[model samples]
Target: MTRKTVRIAMNGVTGRMGHRQHLVRSILALREQGGLELADGTRLWPEPVLVGRREPALRELAGRYGLERWSTDLDAVLADPATDIYFDAQVTSAREEALRKAVAAGKHVYAEKPSATSFEAALGLARLARDAGVKHGVVQDKLFLPGLRKLSRLIDSGFFGQILSVRGEFGYWVFEGDWQEAQRPSWNYRTADGGGIVVDMFPHWEYVLHELFGRVRSVQALAVTHIPQRWDERGKPYDATADDAAYGIFELDGGAVAQINSSWTVRVHRDELVEFQVDGTHGSAVAGLRTCRLQHRSGTPKPVWNPDLPVTHSFRDQWQEVPDNEEFDNGFKTQWELFLRHVYEDGPYRWDLLAGARGVQLAELGLRSSAEGRRVDVPEIAL
Candidate 1:
């Protein structure tokens, strides 16, 4: 079998999501599995070159993985002709410039979203990648979750006859760092550092809604800083400038209304930290990260409304669990494999930089709606 080695310059792997998901679970796991085999039997092997600002962390991580390549200088890494892909999971404030340099170097670019701090910059990156004729993509990992995948299958099978509305609850309490250490980085709470629930999560909601239900027509949102004061990683008190919570009402095409709440301050009361309930004429479904439960019109429970009476039926027991028809792998790994195919074998890849820009656009509009106290129309984005 023919073997092709592709070197990936991975930035920000020292960060939580970057290290755990992108590096360990996705790329490294793929590497351990003897790389990805193409349609014609050619194996595509990924060699990850760690890139970050910290020397010690890079050295330690590279050494831990038994990998030889690691670098603190991003420019030198990008300039290497051997670097076939540039993957960025850096902070939002620093992503745009690094992405620009990578695109200019003619490397295939993939990055975590919000790809940039604003819609303009995200669109610029998309256009730049297009003009450079490079294969580019953004991480839309949530769409590959088992629950969402089952939900997609249900939609394809006409389970939801004329979808009406969707309700999504996402978030768990993030420690303020005063009592317990904060779960997320301190920068995530500062506005100047491109941190906010609206900017961080609206991009996720955009792609999920657009892919499953419909394109968002408009949005009305209210953003708030629930915890104004929080301690940093260094145990230093600072004023939290970014919005920790955002409540949004999104109007999707085909008359589906979606209400989603994103927060870093809310306590989780559901089975999963995040879950979406999609309602339709024929049936309804509630999907979390790993499970999806469906309630058909035939199995629907009816109850008469009474002011003072005992509940008649077990409402929670009514829905049936959707069976997993196929084996599911790590979502990040799955996407990484697909991206490799797209780059080398010319496979279909829709989640390009433009898609990333659309996410950023929704985020920008969501923030605008919150500020203006009015519903904002979502303009169609084009390359």
Candidate 2:
């Protein structure tokens, strides 16, 4: 069977995610797969035409990747008949405008998470795409993690019967810009640029929570800005306008509860950088990024709570390495492939703008809860 090559115009090609999705994922990785060839010898390759605001950066990126087609003019790129899709990894502030232009030009759209700073803007973008009759997707890379996949299998198989509750501990101490080189982008600490831990990460948690347990019914959150000011890349001090840490409690259907603690100011002293522990009436499971620990009903044991007592329970020993069955790419790269297949093959792609809007809703609710000192009910998003 003949394969169709989908041409992609990549916006923000000079940015971090743009470089990864365009040069590494779309160009190199997909090319290595013989253009998304199936086991049965079918192929679907995406030809990338890089686009960015800076001509020098775009030219440099194009030369580095040996890409013959590149441009700084978004309008011209959208008007080109050869482009079938508009890919965006632009800053959150620029997404709505860029996607509006792309949909107006009749191109399918795919973009990074937190698709918009506001829920209304995200809804508008989704409606615009739907009205234009174009496929659309938002990156949900955590769903593709191998460890999470194992947990999903366990849940499906009833390993954790009658699940009770879930706890997520995710964080690592990020250096303050004044003391050491800041690890994350400067805009991430500025409210003007839609920077905040809740806005940036809750979307991931929303999808994970919905996928694992159920939809969130309500959220009560407490958010804090630990570092009030930070230095930029140029070593100039600037006020940190976004919260660096957030503690959230989510109530799911069926009386189940989930607690999430996300911070950029805490050090990791655990087996992995991120850990999720789910407790149930039948058994309990603890999952790290690369490992899973299971304690079934039969293996349950009671131990002393004395801090001086020698630890007897083999809690850490129960964890085993998950065998790799298929070659898995990096999280971002994996989502890119799925989005590509979703656009071309009509695959099951549900990470649409509405889902992205839910993320914005959660963030907005969190902020309101913090300010008003009360819990916020998350209203359902109508697609």
Candidate 3:
């Protein structure tokens, strides 16, 4: 049994997504499971160095996870020749420049998505990684979700004979600082701070829709700041310039339409914070974070439309719940394992920076569509 360690420089891990999802849930979890196993019985162990701006946060995270490496000197770590992978979970505005530096340092690159604020910048990062000959990837965690995986299986198994449409409902009411403490960071409401519902959620929607149905050919979006003013973390009043909500219709390659509504101002009434319903000719399914329900055309209840009669049948109860027959790992960890394998073994890792650039392109065009009050065509990005 042969084993080796791959040193990874993790930047901006003090943040929520980085610390919780990437470092703790994914990397540490992998370490706990005795690392990733390869086909030839070669186990790949990850030696991750936690890099951040704050000393206290870095120390706290390392101590909590029982990790050995922690550093505030990003430049020093980047310049080090031993670091194998450079993973960035920094703010969107800072991602492009930091990534360029990482590629220049000759490190395999991976990062959180909406890789950059603009499509050009995102694509440029991909080009840089390509030119540097470094393995690269972006977090596409939704595709690895258990519910979505089951849906993919069903699709492959021909459960849904002819897919027709997809409707996504994603949102939860975020508290303003007036009464309750704001759940999300104050920067999310500020446009200058690289925040908006469109830029944030459209990327997820783009990948999900593309992987499940087909490519998003066009988008007709309407984005708005439902709450114009809100109090910040310090009880200071500020105008929310970025959009808090985005309603969009994505036209897929095969004419299958996907409608998605993303919001931070809406109240949650559904099963989860995010859910997608796919309707097909043979069957239909609704998938959430960890669960999915299905209803075939044969099992669909027939109800007579009568204004005088009260509704008798429970339509919601008709759908059968999809059972989890196999083990389901954390979505972030799943992708992390796959990426590590891709880095070590050249596995088929599809969510590269170019794919991430397409997501940014979709977000940019979505915003454009909303501003111009017209549908925007999504042109394919040349690799």
Which model, 1 or 3, shows the larger TM-score?
1
Poorly placed runs, candidate 2 (over 4 Å): 38-42, 312-314, 319-326
Candidate 1, residues 128-188, lDDT tens digits: the string is 9999999999999999999999999999999999999999999999999998999998999
Model 3's alpha-carbon lDDT is: 0.92
- Clashing pairs in model 2, backbone N/Cα/C closer than 3 A: none
lDDT score of residue 103 within candidate 2: 90
User: Which one wins on TM-score?
Assistant: 1
Local accuracy of candidate 2 as per-residue lDDT tens digits, 1-383 = 76878889988878876686556865578877777864455687778888888999988888997878889889999999889988888888998899999999999988887888888888888888888899998878777777787777779989888988999988898888787998888898999998989888888888898888998888989989999989999999999999999999998877789999999989998877778888998888877776667788887776568988887667666544445556656766777777777776776788887788777778888888888888888877786
Clashing pairs for predicted structure model 3, backbone only = none
lDDT of 1: 0.95
State the displacement of the C-alpha of residue 320, model 3, in Å, after optimal TM-score superposition.
0.9
C-alpha positional error of residue 276 in candidate 3 after TM-score superposition, expressed in Å: 1.0
Ranking according to lDDT, highest score first: 1, 3, 2
The lDDT of each candidate is: 0.95, 0.83, 0.92
Query: Residue 195 of model 3: what lDDT?
Result: 89
